[model samples]
Target: MAQDWQQLNEQVTALLKTAREQVLAKMQSPLTVDEKTNRKDLVTNVDKSNEQFLIEQIHQIDPAARVLGEEGFGDTLQDLDGRVWIVDPIDGTMNFVKQRDNFAMMIGIYQDGVGQLGYIYDVMQDVLYHGGPALGGVFAGERRLKAPANIALADGLIGASGPLVVHDISHMQAIVHASAGMRVYGSAGIELINIMLGKTLGYISYLKPWDIAAGKVLLEALGCQVTTIDGQPLNMLSSNLVLVATEKAQRDILQIEEDDVSL
Candidate 1:
Protein backbone atom coordinates (compact mmCIF):
# COMPACT_ATOMS: atom_id res chain seq x y z
CA MET A 1 0.00 0.00 0.00
CA ALA A 2 1.24 3.45 -0.94
CA GLN A 3 1.67 5.86 1.95
CA ASP A 4 -0.24 9.12 1.71
CA TRP A 5 2.58 11.50 2.64
CA GLN A 6 0.24 14.47 2.92
CA GLN A 7 -2.02 12.68 5.36
CA LEU A 8 0.95 11.37 7.30
CA ASN A 9 2.43 14.84 7.45
CA GLU A 10 -0.82 16.23 8.85
CA GLN A 11 -0.90 13.57 11.51
CA VAL A 12 2.72 14.16 12.45
CA THR A 13 2.19 17.90 12.69
CA ALA A 14 -0.61 17.43 15.19
CA LEU A 15 1.53 15.03 17.17
CA LEU A 16 4.32 17.58 17.36
CA LYS A 17 1.90 20.14 18.80
CA THR A 18 0.95 17.76 21.53
CA ALA A 19 4.61 17.09 22.22
CA ARG A 20 5.27 20.81 22.41
CA GLU A 21 2.50 21.32 24.93
CA GLN A 22 3.89 18.55 27.07
CA VAL A 23 7.39 20.01 26.95
CA LEU A 24 6.26 23.53 27.77
CA ALA A 25 4.23 22.30 30.71
CA LYS A 26 7.19 20.34 32.05
CA MET A 27 9.37 23.46 31.95
CA GLN A 28 7.47 24.82 34.93
CA SER A 29 9.25 22.35 37.22
CA PRO A 30 12.82 21.27 37.84
CA LEU A 31 14.19 18.73 35.38
CA THR A 32 15.52 15.31 36.35
CA VAL A 33 18.91 15.50 34.67
CA ASP A 34 21.42 12.68 34.34
CA GLU A 35 24.78 12.35 32.66
CA LYS A 36 24.74 10.21 29.54
CA THR A 37 28.46 10.02 28.64
CA ASN A 38 29.97 12.89 30.55
CA ARG A 39 28.93 15.92 32.55
CA LYS A 40 28.79 17.74 29.23
CA ASP A 41 26.45 15.14 27.76
CA LEU A 42 23.16 15.11 29.64
CA VAL A 43 19.65 13.71 29.36
CA THR A 44 16.52 14.56 31.23
CA ASN A 45 13.22 12.93 32.15
CA VAL A 46 11.49 15.02 29.47
CA ASP A 47 13.67 13.55 26.74
CA LYS A 48 12.70 10.00 27.62
CA SER A 49 9.02 10.74 28.11
CA ASN A 50 8.83 12.75 24.91
CA GLU A 51 10.45 9.95 22.91
CA GLN A 52 8.00 7.44 24.33
CA PHE A 53 5.06 9.65 23.41
CA LEU A 54 6.36 10.28 19.89
CA ILE A 55 7.16 6.65 19.16
CA GLU A 56 3.78 5.51 20.49
CA GLN A 57 1.98 8.09 18.38
CA ILE A 58 4.00 7.16 15.32
CA HIS A 59 3.14 3.48 15.77
CA GLN A 60 -0.52 4.43 15.91
CA ILE A 61 -0.16 6.43 12.72
CA ASP A 62 1.54 3.59 10.79
CA PRO A 63 1.92 0.25 12.47
CA ALA A 64 4.24 -0.96 9.72
CA ALA A 65 6.72 1.86 10.07
CA ARG A 66 9.73 1.42 12.36
CA VAL A 67 11.25 4.20 14.40
CA LEU A 68 14.89 4.84 15.44
CA GLY A 69 14.48 7.04 18.46
CA GLU A 70 17.34 8.60 20.41
CA GLU A 71 15.98 7.33 23.73
CA GLY A 72 16.03 3.64 22.73
CA PHE A 73 12.26 3.30 23.05
CA GLY A 74 11.74 2.31 19.40
CA ASP A 75 12.54 -0.61 17.13
CA THR A 76 16.05 -1.82 16.50
CA LEU A 77 16.74 -2.16 12.78
CA GLN A 78 19.75 -3.51 10.96
CA ASP A 79 19.06 -1.30 7.99
CA LEU A 80 16.69 1.33 6.72
CA ASP A 81 15.12 -1.21 4.39
CA GLY A 82 11.51 -0.25 5.02
CA ARG A 83 9.44 2.70 6.12
CA VAL A 84 11.63 4.28 8.83
CA TRP A 85 11.29 7.31 11.02
CA ILE A 86 14.32 8.85 12.75
CA VAL A 87 13.47 10.94 15.75
CA ASP A 88 15.26 13.23 18.23
CA PRO A 89 12.91 13.95 21.09
CA ILE A 90 15.04 16.76 22.46
CA ASP A 91 17.96 18.06 20.48
CA GLY A 92 20.49 20.17 22.41
CA THR A 93 19.79 18.56 25.73
CA MET A 94 22.34 20.77 27.48
CA ASN A 95 20.65 23.89 26.19
CA PHE A 96 17.27 22.50 27.17
CA VAL A 97 18.40 21.71 30.67
CA LYS A 98 20.17 25.00 31.23
CA GLN A 99 18.44 27.62 29.10
CA ARG A 100 15.35 25.86 27.74
CA ASP A 101 15.33 28.18 24.73
CA ASN A 102 17.48 26.85 21.88
CA PHE A 103 16.37 23.22 21.81
CA ALA A 104 14.13 21.49 19.26
CA MET A 105 12.26 18.26 18.49
CA MET A 106 12.93 16.72 15.09
CA ILE A 107 11.62 13.80 13.03
CA GLY A 108 12.58 12.52 9.59
CA ILE A 109 10.64 9.88 7.68
CA TYR A 110 12.33 7.75 5.07
CA GLN A 111 11.35 4.92 2.76
CA ASP A 112 13.97 2.32 1.91
CA GLY A 113 16.60 4.92 2.92
CA VAL A 114 15.18 7.78 0.86
CA GLY A 115 14.13 10.96 2.65
CA GLN A 116 10.37 11.45 2.45
CA LEU A 117 9.35 14.06 5.00
CA GLY A 118 10.95 16.08 7.82
CA TYR A 119 9.72 18.13 10.74
CA ILE A 120 11.79 20.42 13.01
CA TYR A 121 9.83 22.10 15.74
CA ASP A 122 11.54 24.91 17.66
CA VAL A 123 9.61 24.14 20.78
CA MET A 124 10.20 27.43 22.55
CA GLN A 125 9.70 29.69 19.56
CA ASP A 126 6.58 27.85 18.41
CA VAL A 127 8.02 27.53 14.89
CA LEU A 128 7.77 24.36 12.86
CA TYR A 129 9.97 23.86 9.81
CA HIS A 130 8.65 20.97 7.77
CA GLY A 131 8.28 19.43 4.30
CA GLY A 132 10.30 17.50 1.70
CA PRO A 133 10.45 16.40 -1.97
CA ALA A 134 7.09 14.64 -1.92
CA LEU A 135 5.43 17.68 -0.38
CA GLY A 136 6.98 19.97 -3.03
CA GLY A 137 9.26 22.19 -0.85
CA VAL A 138 10.11 23.19 2.70
CA PHE A 139 8.13 25.60 4.85
CA ALA A 140 8.32 27.52 8.16
CA GLY A 141 4.87 27.68 9.63
CA GLU A 142 2.88 28.49 6.42
CA ARG A 143 5.51 30.45 4.47
CA ARG A 144 7.21 28.57 1.63
CA LEU A 145 10.99 28.96 1.86
CA LYS A 146 12.95 29.88 -1.21
CA ALA A 147 16.44 28.63 -1.97
CA PRO A 148 19.06 30.63 -0.11
CA ALA A 149 21.48 32.83 -2.00
CA ASN A 150 24.62 31.08 -3.28
CA ILE A 151 27.11 32.91 -1.09
CA ALA A 152 30.76 31.88 -0.94
CA LEU A 153 32.60 31.02 2.30
CA ALA A 154 34.61 34.25 2.37
CA ASP A 155 31.53 36.36 1.94
CA GLY A 156 29.16 34.89 4.49
CA LEU A 157 28.88 33.97 8.15
CA ILE A 158 29.77 30.31 8.82
CA GLY A 159 28.36 28.21 11.62
CA ALA A 160 30.83 25.99 13.50
CA SER A 161 30.78 23.47 16.27
CA GLY A 162 32.37 25.11 19.31
CA PRO A 163 34.59 22.17 20.13
CA LEU A 164 35.72 21.84 16.52
CA VAL A 165 36.80 25.47 16.53
CA VAL A 166 38.49 25.15 19.93
CA HIS A 167 40.45 22.09 18.80
CA ASP A 168 41.13 23.48 15.29
CA ILE A 169 40.00 20.19 13.81
CA SER A 170 39.61 19.94 10.04
CA HIS A 171 41.31 23.32 9.76
CA MET A 172 38.17 24.79 11.36
CA GLN A 173 40.02 27.96 12.36
CA ALA A 174 41.18 28.56 8.79
CA ILE A 175 37.66 27.93 7.62
CA VAL A 176 36.44 30.56 10.09
CA HIS A 177 39.12 33.01 9.01
CA ALA A 178 38.10 32.54 5.40
CA SER A 179 34.51 33.35 6.29
CA ALA A 180 33.06 36.71 7.30
CA GLY A 181 32.54 35.33 10.87
CA MET A 182 31.34 32.30 12.77
CA ARG A 183 28.21 31.43 14.74
CA VAL A 184 27.75 28.44 17.05
CA TYR A 185 24.18 27.99 18.20
CA GLY A 186 24.92 24.66 20.02
CA SER A 187 22.11 22.84 18.23
CA ALA A 188 22.38 21.20 14.81
CA GLY A 189 18.66 21.63 14.19
CA ILE A 190 18.78 25.32 15.10
CA GLU A 191 21.90 25.85 13.02
CA LEU A 192 20.19 24.13 10.07
CA ILE A 193 17.20 26.38 10.61
CA ASN A 194 19.55 29.36 10.24
CA ILE A 195 20.84 27.88 6.99
CA MET A 196 17.33 27.24 5.62
CA LEU A 197 16.34 30.80 6.45
CA GLY A 198 19.50 32.11 4.70
CA LYS A 199 20.71 33.68 7.93
CA THR A 200 24.05 31.85 7.58
CA LEU A 201 25.92 30.45 4.62
CA GLY A 202 26.63 27.04 6.17
CA TYR A 203 27.32 24.93 9.26
CA ILE A 204 29.95 22.26 10.03
CA SER A 205 29.59 19.82 12.93
CA TYR A 206 30.08 16.23 13.97
CA LEU A 207 26.57 14.84 14.32
CA LYS A 208 24.88 11.55 15.11
CA PRO A 209 22.14 10.05 12.91
CA TRP A 210 19.37 11.53 15.04
CA ASP A 211 21.05 14.93 15.22
CA ILE A 212 21.39 15.50 11.48
CA ALA A 213 18.60 13.36 10.10
CA ALA A 214 15.66 15.76 10.07
CA GLY A 215 17.69 18.82 9.13
CA LYS A 216 19.21 16.87 6.26
CA VAL A 217 15.75 16.25 4.83
CA LEU A 218 14.53 19.81 5.29
CA LEU A 219 17.68 21.56 4.07
CA GLU A 220 18.19 19.39 1.01
CA ALA A 221 14.57 19.96 0.06
CA LEU A 222 15.27 23.71 0.14
CA GLY A 223 18.12 23.30 -2.41
CA CYS A 224 20.98 23.38 0.13
CA GLN A 225 23.73 20.77 0.18
CA VAL A 226 24.33 18.33 3.06
CA THR A 227 27.42 16.13 2.99
CA THR A 228 30.62 15.12 4.71
CA ILE A 229 33.53 17.55 5.08
CA ASP A 230 35.21 16.23 1.91
CA GLY A 231 31.94 16.56 -0.05
CA GLN A 232 31.12 12.88 0.22
CA PRO A 233 27.61 11.42 0.38
CA LEU A 234 26.48 10.49 3.91
CA ASN A 235 25.56 6.89 4.75
CA MET A 236 22.65 8.12 6.92
CA LEU A 237 23.46 5.70 9.73
CA SER A 238 26.82 6.74 11.15
CA SER A 239 28.09 9.85 12.83
CA ASN A 240 30.31 12.08 10.67
CA LEU A 241 31.70 15.57 10.36
CA VAL A 242 28.73 16.80 8.34
CA LEU A 243 28.69 19.97 6.31
CA VAL A 244 25.43 21.75 5.52
CA ALA A 245 25.84 24.78 3.29
CA THR A 246 24.83 26.64 0.17
CA GLU A 247 26.40 25.28 -3.04
CA LYS A 248 28.95 28.06 -3.41
CA ALA A 249 29.96 27.96 0.25
CA GLN A 250 30.31 24.21 0.08
CA ARG A 251 32.66 24.51 -2.87
CA ASP A 252 34.73 27.15 -1.13
CA ILE A 253 35.09 25.23 2.15
CA LEU A 254 36.03 22.00 0.42
CA GLN A 255 38.63 23.90 -1.56
CA ILE A 256 40.07 25.31 1.66
CA GLU A 257 40.29 21.83 3.12
CA GLU A 258 42.07 20.59 0.03
CA ASP A 259 44.57 23.45 0.12
CA ASP A 260 45.31 22.92 3.83
CA VAL A 261 46.41 19.35 3.11
CA SER A 262 48.66 20.52 0.25
CA LEU A 263 50.49 22.85 2.69
Candidate 2:
Protein backbone atom coordinates (compact mmCIF):
# COMPACT_ATOMS: atom_id res chain seq x y z
CA MET A 1 0.00 0.00 0.00
CA ALA A 2 1.18 3.52 -0.78
CA GLN A 3 1.77 5.76 2.25
CA ASP A 4 1.03 9.44 2.15
CA TRP A 5 3.79 10.68 4.45
CA GLN A 6 2.64 14.29 4.49
CA GLN A 7 -0.87 13.21 5.44
CA LEU A 8 0.56 11.01 8.17
CA ASN A 9 2.59 13.94 9.46
CA GLU A 10 -0.54 16.09 9.66
CA GLN A 11 -2.38 13.39 11.61
CA VAL A 12 0.52 12.95 14.05
CA THR A 13 0.73 16.72 14.60
CA ALA A 14 -2.91 16.84 15.64
CA LEU A 15 -2.43 13.76 17.80
CA LEU A 16 0.43 15.36 19.74
CA LYS A 17 -1.64 18.47 20.49
CA THR A 18 -4.55 16.33 21.73
CA ALA A 19 -2.20 14.31 23.93
CA ARG A 20 -0.80 17.54 25.37
CA GLU A 21 -4.29 18.67 26.32
CA GLN A 22 -4.99 15.32 27.97
CA VAL A 23 -1.77 15.51 29.97
CA LEU A 24 -2.42 19.07 31.17
CA ALA A 25 -5.96 18.13 32.20
CA LYS A 26 -4.69 15.16 34.20
CA MET A 27 -2.16 17.34 36.03
CA GLN A 28 -4.85 19.55 37.53
CA SER A 29 -5.39 17.06 40.36
CA PRO A 30 -3.24 15.14 42.81
CA LEU A 31 -1.09 12.40 41.29
CA THR A 32 -0.38 8.83 42.39
CA VAL A 33 3.34 8.15 42.04
CA ASP A 34 5.37 4.93 42.24
CA GLU A 35 9.01 3.94 42.13
CA LYS A 36 10.13 2.11 38.99
CA THR A 37 13.80 1.31 39.69
CA ASN A 38 14.83 3.42 42.66
CA ARG A 39 13.88 6.45 44.70
CA LYS A 40 14.95 8.80 41.92
CA ASP A 41 13.28 6.83 39.12
CA LEU A 42 9.51 7.34 39.29
CA VAL A 43 6.29 6.96 37.38
CA THR A 44 2.86 8.40 38.08
CA ASN A 45 -0.79 7.93 37.15
CA VAL A 46 -0.33 10.73 34.64
CA ASP A 47 2.44 8.89 32.81
CA LYS A 48 0.50 5.65 32.49
CA SER A 49 -2.73 7.38 31.51
CA ASN A 50 -0.99 9.57 28.98
CA GLU A 51 0.78 6.65 27.31
CA GLN A 52 -2.45 4.68 27.08
CA PHE A 53 -4.23 7.66 25.58
CA LEU A 54 -1.49 8.23 23.00
CA ILE A 55 -1.20 4.60 21.97
CA GLU A 56 -4.95 4.21 21.61
CA GLN A 57 -5.30 7.31 19.48
CA ILE A 58 -2.32 6.30 17.34
CA HIS A 59 -3.85 2.92 16.58
CA GLN A 60 -7.01 4.64 15.43
CA ILE A 61 -5.03 6.75 12.99
CA ASP A 62 -2.91 3.91 11.59
CA PRO A 63 -4.34 0.61 12.65
CA ALA A 64 -1.53 -1.28 10.94
CA ALA A 65 1.20 0.69 12.65
CA ARG A 66 3.06 -0.95 15.54
CA VAL A 67 3.70 1.12 18.64
CA LEU A 68 6.38 0.84 21.29
CA GLY A 69 5.54 2.87 24.40
CA GLU A 70 7.37 3.27 27.69
CA GLU A 71 4.40 2.47 29.95
CA GLY A 72 3.86 -1.08 28.54
CA PHE A 73 0.59 -0.13 26.93
CA GLY A 74 1.83 -1.03 23.44
CA ASP A 75 3.48 -3.96 21.71
CA THR A 76 6.61 -5.77 22.73
CA LEU A 77 8.49 -5.41 19.50
CA GLN A 78 11.78 -7.11 18.77
CA ASP A 79 12.40 -5.51 15.40
CA LEU A 80 11.64 -2.37 13.44
CA ASP A 81 10.46 -4.07 10.26
CA GLY A 82 7.50 -1.96 9.21
CA ARG A 83 5.65 1.16 10.25
CA VAL A 84 6.80 1.55 13.85
CA TRP A 85 5.99 4.35 16.26
CA ILE A 86 8.18 4.97 19.29
CA VAL A 87 6.63 7.08 22.01
CA ASP A 88 7.68 8.54 25.32
CA PRO A 89 4.33 9.71 26.64
CA ILE A 90 6.14 11.96 29.05
CA ASP A 91 9.90 12.39 29.08
CA GLY A 92 11.43 13.54 32.38
CA THR A 93 8.78 11.96 34.59
CA MET A 94 10.77 13.14 37.61
CA ASN A 95 10.60 16.74 36.48
CA PHE A 96 6.92 16.33 35.59
CA VAL A 97 5.98 14.90 39.00
CA LYS A 98 8.12 17.13 41.17
CA GLN A 99 8.62 20.37 39.25
CA ARG A 100 5.57 20.03 36.94
CA ASP A 101 7.73 21.57 34.23
CA ASN A 102 10.72 20.76 32.02
CA PHE A 103 8.97 17.67 30.70
CA ALA A 104 8.01 16.84 27.13
CA MET A 105 5.92 14.32 25.19
CA MET A 106 7.75 12.83 22.21
CA ILE A 107 6.79 10.60 19.29
CA GLY A 108 8.74 9.35 16.30
CA ILE A 109 7.51 7.48 13.23
CA TYR A 110 9.77 5.14 11.32
CA GLN A 111 9.29 3.00 8.24
CA ASP A 112 11.65 0.08 7.75
CA GLY A 113 13.98 1.58 10.31
CA VAL A 114 14.15 5.04 8.73
CA GLY A 115 12.81 8.09 10.55
CA GLN A 116 9.87 9.67 8.72
CA LEU A 117 8.43 12.21 11.14
CA GLY A 118 8.99 13.32 14.71
CA TYR A 119 7.18 15.43 17.30
CA ILE A 120 8.24 16.73 20.69
CA TYR A 121 5.82 18.86 22.65
CA ASP A 122 6.89 20.93 25.65
CA VAL A 123 3.56 20.70 27.41
CA MET A 124 3.96 23.39 30.06
CA GLN A 125 5.59 25.83 27.68
CA ASP A 126 3.03 25.10 24.96
CA VAL A 127 5.82 24.85 22.41
CA LEU A 128 6.02 22.04 19.89
CA TYR A 129 9.14 21.16 17.87
CA HIS A 130 8.33 18.89 15.00
CA GLY A 131 9.31 17.76 11.48
CA GLY A 132 11.52 15.28 9.61
CA PRO A 133 13.21 14.62 6.25
CA ALA A 134 9.84 14.25 4.53
CA LEU A 135 8.71 17.58 5.98
CA GLY A 136 11.68 19.44 4.39
CA GLY A 137 13.02 20.88 7.68
CA VAL A 138 12.27 21.09 11.36
CA PHE A 139 9.91 23.71 12.79
CA ALA A 140 8.97 25.34 16.06
CA GLY A 141 5.22 25.51 15.56
CA GLU A 142 4.70 27.40 12.28
CA ARG A 143 8.19 28.85 12.13
CA ARG A 144 10.72 26.94 10.05
CA LEU A 145 14.03 26.47 11.83
CA LYS A 146 17.36 27.08 10.21
CA ALA A 147 20.39 24.94 10.82
CA PRO A 148 22.18 25.99 14.00
CA ALA A 149 25.64 27.45 13.57
CA ASN A 150 28.39 24.85 13.60
CA ILE A 151 30.08 26.20 16.70
CA ALA A 152 33.16 24.58 18.24
CA LEU A 153 33.08 22.98 21.69
CA ALA A 154 35.11 25.66 23.49
CA ASP A 155 33.02 28.44 21.99
CA GLY A 156 29.54 27.31 23.12
CA LEU A 157 27.54 25.88 26.01
CA ILE A 158 26.91 22.12 26.13
CA GLY A 159 24.05 20.11 27.60
CA ALA A 160 25.02 17.11 29.71
CA SER A 161 23.45 14.46 31.87
CA GLY A 162 23.70 15.34 35.55
CA PRO A 163 25.00 11.94 36.61
CA LEU A 164 27.57 11.77 33.83
CA VAL A 165 28.96 15.17 34.74
CA VAL A 166 28.95 14.50 38.49
CA HIS A 167 30.57 11.06 38.21
CA ASP A 168 33.01 12.07 35.47
CA ILE A 169 31.99 9.16 33.27
CA SER A 170 33.59 8.91 29.80
CA HIS A 171 35.85 11.82 30.68
CA MET A 172 32.72 13.94 30.95
CA GLN A 173 34.43 16.49 33.17
CA ALA A 174 37.20 16.89 30.64
CA ILE A 175 34.66 17.30 27.86
CA VAL A 176 32.81 19.97 29.87
CA HIS A 177 36.03 21.82 30.67
CA ALA A 178 36.87 21.79 26.98
CA SER A 179 33.54 23.50 26.36
CA ALA A 180 32.43 26.91 27.62
CA GLY A 181 30.21 25.26 30.31
CA MET A 182 27.54 22.62 30.82
CA ARG A 183 23.82 22.79 31.55
CA VAL A 184 21.79 19.84 32.81
CA TYR A 185 18.09 20.17 31.96
CA GLY A 186 17.15 16.55 32.96
CA SER A 187 15.08 16.13 29.80
CA ALA A 188 16.55 15.08 26.46
CA GLY A 189 13.73 16.78 24.56
CA ILE A 190 14.50 20.14 26.15
CA GLU A 191 18.22 19.66 25.57
CA LEU A 192 17.56 18.86 21.93
CA ILE A 193 15.36 21.94 21.68
CA ASN A 194 18.14 24.14 23.03
CA ILE A 195 20.52 22.66 20.47
CA MET A 196 18.11 23.19 17.57
CA LEU A 197 17.51 26.79 18.59
CA GLY A 198 21.29 27.39 18.56
CA LYS A 199 21.15 28.09 22.31
CA THR A 200 23.57 25.22 22.94
CA LEU A 201 26.18 23.77 20.61
CA GLY A 202 25.94 20.18 21.85
CA TYR A 203 24.47 17.64 24.28
CA ILE A 204 25.81 14.36 25.70
CA SER A 205 23.74 11.91 27.73
CA TYR A 206 22.73 8.34 28.38
CA LEU A 207 19.52 7.80 26.45
CA LYS A 208 17.10 5.00 25.68
CA PRO A 209 15.33 4.39 22.39
CA TRP A 210 12.38 6.61 23.21
CA ASP A 211 14.49 9.34 24.76
CA ILE A 212 16.47 9.98 21.59
CA ALA A 213 14.06 8.89 18.88
CA ALA A 214 12.07 12.06 18.18
CA GLY A 215 14.96 14.39 18.85
CA LYS A 216 17.17 12.40 16.49
CA VAL A 217 14.77 12.91 13.63
CA LEU A 218 14.52 16.66 14.20
CA LEU A 219 18.22 17.28 14.80
CA GLU A 220 19.40 15.22 11.85
CA ALA A 221 16.96 17.15 9.67
CA LEU A 222 18.56 20.36 10.87
CA GLY A 223 22.05 18.99 9.90
CA CYS A 224 23.14 18.19 13.47
CA GLN A 225 25.01 14.97 14.21
CA VAL A 226 23.29 12.32 16.38
CA THR A 227 25.48 9.38 17.26
CA THR A 228 26.84 7.26 20.06
CA ILE A 229 29.53 8.75 22.29
CA ASP A 230 32.14 6.88 20.24
CA GLY A 231 30.55 8.36 17.11
CA GLN A 232 28.90 5.12 15.94
CA PRO A 233 25.45 4.58 14.48
CA LEU A 234 22.69 4.20 17.10
CA ASN A 235 21.04 0.81 17.50
CA MET A 236 17.63 2.33 18.30
CA LEU A 237 16.90 -0.79 20.41
CA SER A 238 19.60 -0.28 23.03
CA SER A 239 20.35 2.38 25.62
CA ASN A 240 23.47 4.36 24.78
CA LEU A 241 25.70 7.21 25.78
CA VAL A 242 24.62 9.48 22.95
CA LEU A 243 26.05 12.66 21.46
CA VAL A 244 23.98 15.27 19.60
CA ALA A 245 25.88 18.27 18.38
CA THR A 246 26.78 20.45 15.47
CA GLU A 247 29.54 19.14 13.16
CA LYS A 248 32.38 21.13 14.64
CA ALA A 249 31.28 20.53 18.23
CA GLN A 250 31.08 16.79 17.55
CA ARG A 251 34.61 16.80 16.13
CA ASP A 252 35.87 18.68 19.17
CA ILE A 253 34.13 16.26 21.52
CA LEU A 254 35.33 13.11 19.82
CA GLN A 255 38.88 14.41 19.80
CA ILE A 256 39.03 15.74 23.41
CA GLU A 257 42.21 14.65 25.22
CA GLU A 258 41.31 12.63 28.32
CA ASP A 259 43.68 13.25 31.24
CA ASP A 260 43.62 14.11 34.94
CA VAL A 261 40.78 16.62 34.70
CA SER A 262 39.10 17.89 37.86
CA LEU A 263 35.76 19.61 38.21
Q: Considering only N, C-alpha and C atoms within 3 Å, which residue pairs clash in candidate 1?
A: none
Give Cα-based local distance difference scores for all models: 0.91, 0.90
Stretches off by above 4 angstroms in model 2 are: 1-3, 257-263
Candidate 2 similarity to native, TM-score: 0.96
- Angstrom error of the Cα, residue 187, model 2: value is 0.7
For model 1, the stretches where C-alpha displacement exceeds 4 angstroms are 1-3, 261-263
Query: Looking at candidate 1, what is the lDDT of residue 138?
Result: 94
Superposition error at 65 for model 1 (Å): 0.8
lDDT per residue for candidate 1 within 1-263, as digits (tens), equals 23588888889999999999999999999999999989998999999999999999999999999999988999887899889999999999989998889999999999999898899999999999999976889999999999899889888899999999999889899889988999999888899899999899999999888998899899899888999999999878778899999999999889989888421
Task: Summarize candidate 2's per-residue lDDT along 1-263 as a digit string, tens digits.
Answer: 22487788888888888888888888989999999989988899988998999999999999999999988899988899999999999899989988999999999988889987889999899999999987888999999999999989999999999999889988799989989999999898889999999999989999989999999999999999999988899988879899999999898888763333455
How many clashes show up in model 1? 0
